[model samples]
Target: MSQTLDAAAVRSWCSLALDALGREREEIDAINVYPVADGDTGTNLYLTVESAAQAVEAVFAAHATGTTEPAPADAVRAMAHGALIGARGNSGTILAQLLRGMAQVLAPPAPGDGDHAARLAPALRRAAELARAAVAHPVEGTILTVASAAADAAEAAGADGRKAGGTRTDGTRTDVAATVRAAYAGARAALDATPDQLAVLGRAGVVDAGGRGLLAVLGALVRALTGEVPAVPPAGHRRPEEPAAPGPGSGPGAERDGGPAFEVIYLLEAGDAAVTRLRERLDALGDSLVVVGGDGLWNVHVHVDDAGAAVEAGVEAGRPYRIRITHFGATAEHPPEQVQRAVVAVVPGEGLAGLCAEAGATTVLARPGEPPASGELVEAIRRAHAREVVLLPNDAALRHTAAAAAEQARTEGVRVALIPTRAAVQGIAALAVHQPDRRFDEDVVAMTTAAGATRYAELAVAERQSWTMAGICQAGDVLGLIEGDVAVIGADLAATAEAVLTRMLAAGGELVTLVLGEDVPDGDALADRLERYVREGHLAVDTVVYRGGRQSVPLLVGVE
Candidate 1:
């Protein structure tokens, strides 16, 4: 084994952590009793670490052309950044902050030749501190307490090694392997004692769910450093003397019994000062509040009755994207066993999100510049809380991301089918034909047929001079693209849209779908004009226009 911690070790650590979490996820979820008994702590931790692992792998991929692998600092920083933006629920949010803190200690570019092993103790300590600070109200006997105990033990071990002449009382320096082993041992001890420290765990006859998850992570770290996986029992397997009782706020009345009605999470871009104010405002509106990230980007997670108010607060702070709001109140009423099927779609705007939600699909909002990560898509699939799910990516660029999410969901026992809907308009067509009551394969085929039959086109304004299939266009020119290629360029938005629609209709169409973006001035007038043109030119065709607010393009046309 390598004596010093390095880039390869960080990569190994991430992969190992993800594996460990995957093994313990359901066990940990079964014992989830604190913060909220939604029973997703294990899954949340696994997803958070999966994001971190992917980030580290991306860093390695970026350096593949070089002579050497990425530096340890670069790898660790990538891991931290990935976790921040991709974090899911409350436990996931706190886990992101903890990784960020560790990265803060390990990612410095300068002071390159220091003892990396010695830094592990401080990194653990810093991680625990940052995690506790991120929570609105830190409670003991949870992941926070487990993390602190791990740090304390790692630090004590380091001290003891130094006291012994810094050479194991021999002639070799203390290695990272020893530090991680001590931390894992400490976390395991803390996890075992959590039931005594928290009343909920005691009543449930289980250790803290988050604590169990942290132990798995710490155990993974030990395996990454040394080549031995720590022997940690699954939470569900380790029953207390008494039969396990249902934890408080767990049954059908969880929401009514003082729990928040919804779980709101979003990624925000704001200045530090703005984020501070956002924290204050969110704290008053809900509980389980966690805001993690820095350097102008943040991930906000909280539980509240007014999901809109929580999101509005993020907007006031700055631009918030990839917004996800899940209704926990309804979850208690419909257990996982009861849900048979669901549709998960990626929409571009809040208006479209509302539209999809009304159609009984769980929506993941994709902002103009910021797209939802694969982890976010996976979380959305989980949130759908169904036995089978049909995923509509709605954009060609997201094909791979959607595929990866589908694979992940399948591993969690969700039957997922990925439909290649290349546009939101196509997604709309698919949703129109979605019938959850039908057989899963039959439903998927119907949605796919609808999406495929819809020929889509979009109208966008050029941001800079660019060459198109039709001709070269200058900045501020109206560009019309058909089926993902530029087909028309003009000075007027309406004229360009008409030209594109004419081309699409030349082949013959029965139905026309017009989605108007929020930015177009007097959008209603433009929609009316387009509707009139379609009606006049194609008398046999029907027209439908929708207000696709704040979408990426000025107009989207779909002909079927």
Candidate 2:
């Protein structure tokens, strides 16, 4: 039975591709040794398809809710645009152009012209050609090789099917599923042969990561059209890129070789002529120059020593924004082979920062009235000199900043998890359970759970008269805040601290942590008084205190 290519089929392909990539992300990332050994190819492909799927869904949603139905061209174009805007690394940028090339041939489906089904072969063929053309230095044994092979196989399949009397020359439905299956089969075959073509892959003892990702995407396309995934050859399953602390008899490693220092990517809005010149300039600057997308928009990717110069060339050509810079040698600060994992915490005061550092954390100090920027957090993560990291931004206002930092680190091939610690006390609670020997995900879960289970509070003096949750108080009055809001007001700092403690311990607590600032009325005396109050009232509650040093906020409190 033959199938016709419709808008629904295209939507399904995008969603299926995303799902397949998601399942294969870690494996693909592990095998990524080409261009640079900073592993992230699998993750990049998944993010690229995720963006495309979102755009396709948006088109379908509009058709479902509005009076007008979306056409096949609309869905395809949206997918291309989404990929262009959201493409991640080198492979992702090229993959976006490949999909865009397909749109170039199949969009605005011609009536009585056999629809998209008949055009699949030509679309794929063009996708391969365009993708190859987009790369300044097109190398075989990568995703480009797989894409080209897929297109060639699809064309060959169509030719054979026509001769076997399965022709659709009279403008009837074509065997779209057959075309997809052929493409997937060809990509799989090409993926297996990648090691022979690329010396890096051969040295790494793995197939091209980018090629494997493309194979998975093609497998999804086949699944969309045929209701079954293509049967890909099974390779001996093993993880070769898992990070481990340097030790004898640990990790199977490839031949160590250094490449470019940084990967710089950005979306540029420039004319084709400007892009042509920009390509030539960027090629001279570094390797892996994939200048994809066109018609006044382009996604630029390159690896270079001077990341600023790569971005500046885009500025000379046209407007480039969403600039992402990643140093390839993320673990340069530490011994290369010893690269393992670390925790990066943003703490407000010197005392907290020192405590975090003592617990084996890479601490980013946040001075009073100055929040750490996204770049600072990124640098701190890099300074940790580990392949994997857990980030704790111990302030409510820095959530967005922390998320952005995490995303930026991910592009540089660093696996960073951001734990939303709303206060320094929460960070402390999370750090208490930090176990580096545990699995990354397990450690993150333990930290997040501990942070969430703790209740945090702060005591400060009102600088000026203002309305409070308790009542309006004049300047110099003490304010007791539980979870960032004023809950009690008093004339004495020690009295206000005790009130906050009583309110927090009412629900029951096993441990109480107090960080007393320099402004505390006799730091040692205030902590002793609070410790006594907890002992006398909330029996069995253990208390720990730290000298917070010079800080604007008088006291930091937490109950767990």
Candidate 3:
């Protein structure tokens, strides 16, 4: 008979869940059909669990400092809360709410009589209720089905325990363990039946990925009950490995260092204290800890057996922006033969695409209509055989997707980087300085620095009259965005453009490159106005280049 769960037990369960998630994430991502190509259900659930695990670790650490035993309920609640705030995408939101319900059921009064197993049934039931309420239209074959089945089975098992003259109401019931075990069994059965309920799943010849993801979670919980830790999936199940390290005297592009021995990387918010703390924690874990901090972000690379533990430590120090764990054996020692890099530009016109192609970016997944999906970006990179891919999301709306893609790639052993360039002009500037042979870190720095040096200006008409944008914007009003922020709004396009240009160029610019969108009147006309401004202001100008094309938006100009 199982008794109570300790902090270590909780950690074991969380780790197992994450391992299960890691094993199936890609499969779930590939089979999602209801939402079309926006299939991040697996990724979202994985991130959500990871966030919760970190929270649990923090709770445990805090409890260890005191005399009191770690409260499993409290730690679980913290994890659920973290998942709520860190949740992304539809599936992620639903998963967060489910965990929230679980937390609520597991809260306070401390399950009387130390009957940990009895509480599982009620918690499962609450999770189902919460998950059902989260979705506007709940589907039967997805996560909802699995959770519901588990909850119902737990209730049934509890009833059976009572019928057998076992302790059910005392909360000291050891029979509750049996109930949870039964629940997991029922949940697995329901998972197998998912395809029968949803025709789409049947047609796809696979069970619902979301449903399977929930099963994985339940499986972890069951494993915890059995005092077992889940193992990470073998390398074959993950992303392809990097090439082997080149031998001695291997040519210029030869593999080096026998494939990095192990590539350890993690993400955290950027700060001196955070970096210092992470360095200290990683030092104890392993060697070769390279700490890189930039743009309010930090990436810690360390080789260690405790990858998850290292991530947990980082989360305790600060909120993690992203987290990736990969073994050197899982990836090639050197870069692939064709390290094709693809760039996604969120510009609003055609000229940007041409410029992107000329800059050596073979495939350009333009966000012409709706925001591009992460899968689309992933597919583009895969199609390009991009060993080291650089994503340039020139629109703020698409920035999150790019960042998520980069995080996913890193997890899967792909060398991916994102340059948060907010405009096509900035992307163009960065592309101008890109070097194919440079190391990824160096290339990213060079491109980002180049983008930062350029000033941007654009002219566009408002699409709506809603009380949006702080009442400063109206229909037909010309709007100008400086570095992606709406800085000037007025009735005249040229005046707004001029004001933005003047502000951006105030820091002293040598040349101005104006790439007008299809909506703009004419590139030459705008260039002439800018040239006159430069001559009249006695500003030393080198040259004015004008180009016109269609893009995701209108009017992208870069001044250097």
Candidate 4:
């Protein structure tokens, strides 16, 4: 009747939470009115939880050969770490801290040596407290309020249950189902009352969007522990008779309407002392400031007029990576206009996506095993908002998917051209030659020619003992693939990359491009070494490098 809070339960919680968020994402986005009103709160929370779920799955996969399952501590720690690194926007950042707080209590032994159900109350309380502390100025009517209410309800429910014969003869208290149900009910009530607490929500005739999302998450937790799906609430947390007010950012006194123009977020590796000072600096520089995470890692989020200054503060604090800065409105250089042509590219990582975006291409980020679906590509083409679109499927495996998306867009009255780019490096080459101002056919031909002329290779680790063109390779061997065939196998990343580069350069001519993945240790040094090797061995060849973020492979090589 009672589900124990073990590793399997944690895994199920992550999966269930993700599905719940996915279903409510659009409704939550519609109700987002606070902290900038960009209408992406739901999307941000979904991505954050998706990352956590993936991390938990990875832990289970790692123990596939072992007799014992992954420990609960390992699973929860991974979930918190994943959320911290992948968190986006203000609501998502606070949610990460909440999960981290729960992990603090759950990952270690209980103070009184209590059972798993007995730990739930304290975990919820810690989650609320830590989340409140993470925000620079804690708001009363947001997710923080709902979280605190849930904690209080959980504690109260445990106390009541113990008084009502819930405690066993051995002294174990209430079950997890009771605790989770109480928390979810309390959160739901808090969400409904948010309009009365927050002025903006009151004006908009809707409850707090972040609070509503938190309620959904707690509902999933209820299902995870009790095997009972909570009743779904109305859309946008608005009452049936209440007429909708103006949409966010449409009227006077709108929350964060004329606020800071940019939202900057990044993952920082820094000491606690550095973080303390860093928080003060960021608070002075912006509003909606939240610095979440600890133990030498943090996720820093802020809204600032000066995006560069916010980033500089992180640099002073420590090593900051996966930096994302989003503009809230149109820029001077790119005024709102219906374009004639646009490039839609499927890129492997965030860095490459940013690069392609800067080059005026609409980018769809492709994660390790999660390739973009045809519908997602179609959405990107729609987002491009152009008369003619050039689609680049960066991986060869996405060729048919890209074609389907193109055909779909064609039905929507958009001209589409699909470029057969077998790798990210080839996409980079095609982007280099793209000129939207040129004739549509001419531009397509130019991009196609550039992609075809570029020779591409990648560095990957063999998952198991396998036969290759080069020879037999064992698991953990760095296999250098040239034009999709294995040519060299080495023990080290730099060495294998070098071998791949040498082989590609033997028949090459002018320039070399290297894209380094996040997993590549000392990537800058490796890039420097490879560049030197190329300069010394090849005549009249130029070299360039780019950080590809967390791609599937260690290195991508291209020579033209």
Candidate 5:
């Protein structure tokens, strides 16, 4: 009986879903059993959804058209598209793909059918398929599995309804309320079984976080349809603060020689002519102009300094919509002290933070949590007052943020270098050889070389079933990675650790340093076994440092 969804319902569902994800973000991250402890799945999924929600809200406000039914297909499409470009980690990417597929199915036709429920059934099915395709290899007991089950259930509901003469031909049939309810039940059931299906979840005593996030979104959608808000618990994660207000010199007419401090964002609703003119005007103002979200609503995000001017320009173009202006300052800035240099690292866990700090890094930004903003990073470096700054973005997810920080710092006349270190182990290795007194260029070259020479080894669980370079990884298999590549897969952590160690030392290393991670089993026992290998003349020990805390991975630094 549902005809079309209004903007408010779409916004409400998205907000409810995000609230659910915010409550359980950390628990999902902890289920990462890969030798490396980059638990960012929960965080990534939440951010992806949050971006979509924001886009939906912007679109609704710009259009200002009222409807009490289900959300229009175009609205869903805009939200999906926004999430696609803003997606961060692997989980986020997969979720974005799912949204993209769903959007395609829900795309309006030439005639623009008003049957929202009918369109959604097909969209949900396509979403599942797209999500499965996004992964190199699909795995059960994961998000893919949950989505697939939900899609199948929805399809089944459609089929049952069709048999009862409720559906129509051309795939534009209506009356999907029963199907949606059935799909939700199926998805919830699948989510509950994730712990038993995946060993990491079993160990962590939780369901698959990504799967849970998808379930939350689905639950919200069902609630919107049924007019009943499900009692979904909040997912545990950091709440993103509302965008800050424009500063004293930050309004529309503000002028600066370099540019404004933050990027100004606003949504515009007008005809095509207005949009074209606005685009040309904003092009002259700043860079990174992403003007998306169509269907009488234009979601505008631009990097500009003159917030007031930008707002004026937008207002002049068309009706002013939901306005959110964030000030993203320049990336690079000069430091005061010529003797000291700062290195900013993006690593997870306290143990890695300690290691980076010991290695002359002034600041260590934790991952799988709220990463420091570019402005914050620049401020941190400026506070350190170092002459030259080096950024070690240990997590690949933080690379863009680090680059942005570096860019802002450079703009502020700070000497900053961003070393593309992908893992915490690499960051630690790079730091070991960093010479603070050396020339900046020389130090960068030396650190890059050291990072390349280092190898990583750790014991963890496989998050999904995929064919890695090492072998076929199952849901519960304990995995070990060497030099950023999967090295071993087995149930026994000690055995896998031994295999990784042997491979790392097979290159005839002179000295081996093993830094045991927090969740590593029996550090002393593992070290003792390694000692026997050293005594056998296989490798020499160079003082093994054991730190009991979370880190990227157990590292094996080969000292020549």
Candidate 6:
């Protein structure tokens, strides 16, 4: 039996929770009769867990090439952060808060935390308290009640352990496993009692949908600790003889009791004071208000009549992006519409950015000497709002980072394919033939083929004296690098570019594209002369030029 909650155990818990939610999503959706009976509690829960699982996977990927394992704190923090950014609905938002609360205590696992079990009781308690505080209107007979009972049971179990000589030599609790087991048992009992605590649940002949989701999560935690999966619990009505009246929140569009018309959510970059004010403003605007995350970044969610006003509030307080608005009433019976495909490319220059944008691809600008993190790529995918996505890293060094981002996006139900485009020109070539209407696999293959067929070269001034493949080059020497290796060294810009172009075409080519940087000397004249040379020396070879405006490199050449 497993006894400690290490990094691996945390990962296991997230994976198990996702699997459990997947198995029970439809059942939970059928019984969502409280706050709003939109029939998506199970799906939201699954999505929230998926995000958490992705975060854990990212943490592990970061350490994949290393000898040491990641600390439990690192894993826990990623899980919480993932949930905050990807939370879907009311229940999902509260679950994010609960994970955040647990992370607060478990992230820095105290000095004397010998066994992982000792930390479970306190984390569960903190999670319960924070989850309660996050909700605008606290209601019992729901997930809140179930979470609270679990905490209470954990504390009671701790007390029982103390009475049974559970104290360590330093007078600390010794039996953390017992406390966790008790908490899981208490949560299950609370879930069964949910029908009695709420009139809506009783009328609908179902348990609280949110409570059932929490029970599944807690049971996953138990399995992760002890290596024994629990039997799936029943949802909704226990007996066929029980009443099955339609939920009170049911109307023509399930907009019963005149609640908000839309659900608005976004990620905001703001200060703590601004967030406090935002909370107050949002609470007044609508019900089911949830603001989660910290340290300059936050995830805001609320149900409101005016979705525009809700997004405007975020803009007034701070910068908000990835704004998603859903009509709660209109889609009561129908699922959401899916976008076919999108491409997210990381480009080095503004010119390339515009080009990619015009080709129906989302572009991320790469600042000089500053690379983007995996989170930024994930955010870009979120902004695309498509079911299928193609990602272009545009740099060889970013292969690992791009892979991690694609993995994270996949967890959130996005189909992401990472194309290894080692240069911006290759990405440009790939985007030239993007077909959103085509099959996913066929489109990906076509893009990949375009990117692979292009042979790329760059012109840059040597930073310092160094020996290269061609010869020894001094600082200020114009260096021509082909396929990441220096192939030609010359004293003049025109001479070096001519030699590089000659060598590239020697391998044979039908088309050549030249990108001139901000500092390129005589840019227009150089491009004209190159085009003339290609036409004269290699018949039927076409040439094109664009103002690259990128730093460090003075010119880029791609031959296909």
Q: Report lDDT (CA) for all predictions.
A: 0.86, 0.82, 0.64, 0.85, 0.64, 0.83
Tens digits of lDDT, candidate 5, 373-408: 444465456555676888887666667878988987
In Å, residue 295's CA in model 6 sits off its true spot by: 3.0
**Which scores better on TM-score, 2 or 4?**
4
lDDT string for model 2 (213-305, tens) is 888878877877778867755421332552224234222233224457888998898999999999999999889999899889899999888
| Weakest ten-residue segment in model 2 by summed lDDT | 247-256
Q: 4 or 6, which is superior by TM-score?
A: 4
C-alpha RMSD by candidate, in order: 4.2, 12.5, 17.8, 5.3, 22.0, 7.3
Q: What is the TM-score of each predicted model, taking all chains together?
A: 0.83, 0.60, 0.48, 0.80, 0.42, 0.69
lDDT by residue for model 6 (1-560), tens: 45677889899999999889878987998888777777878878887888788888889999999998899899999999888877778888889989998899888856764565677788889999988887778888999999999998998988788778746564445565677689889999998888788877766777899999999999898888877677677876644655445545532234345788788988789999998988999999998887877789887889899899899999988988656677765443554465779999997776777778889998776645445556567767866878999999999988998998899899989999999999988998899878889999999999999999999999989989998999899999999999999999999888898899999999888889888887787888888888888888988899989886655588889999
Task: Kindly list the per-residue Cα lDDT of model 3 for residues 1-560, writing each as its tens digit.
Answer: 12445456667767788888877877776655432223556776776677667667767778787888576667776767656544443455566667777777666555456545667788889888877754544678777888899999999988887788855464466564576578788887887777578655554445666776777787787777765433322211111232244234332212223323333444466577766766777777765454533345544555566667777777776766324444433322232356545554544544656667676774443424434455445645654456787778776667887787778777767788888887667787888888878777888899999888877776677888644342567788878877666778878766776787777777888777777666666657767886687667645865455454645445666788
Order of the predicted models by lDDT, top scorer first: 1, 4, 6, 2, 3, 5
lDDT of 5 at 145: 80
The list of candidate 1 runs beyond 4 A from truth reads 1-7, 60-68, 112-115, 166-174, 236-256, 332-341, 368-382, 385-388, 397-417, 435-442, 458-481, 485-503, 516-543, 550-555
Question: In model 4, which runs have C-alpha deviations exceeding 4 angstroms?
Answer: 66-68, 109-115, 167-173, 237-253, 330-341, 344-358, 362-422, 435-453, 459-479, 490-555
Residue 525 displacement in candidate 5 (angstroms): 66
Rank by TM-score, descending? 1, 4, 6, 2, 3, 5
lDDT of 1: 0.86
Please give the TM-score that candidate 2 achieves against the real structure. 0.60
State the weakest 10-residue window (summed lDDT) of model 5: 328-337
Alpha carbon lDDT at 467, candidate 5: 96
Using TM-score as the yardstick, the better of models 3 and 6 is: 6
Question: Residue by residue across 175-287, what tens digits does model 1's lDDT show?
Answer: 57779889988998988888789866766677888888888888877887788868987584434564555655543234237668889999999999999999999999999
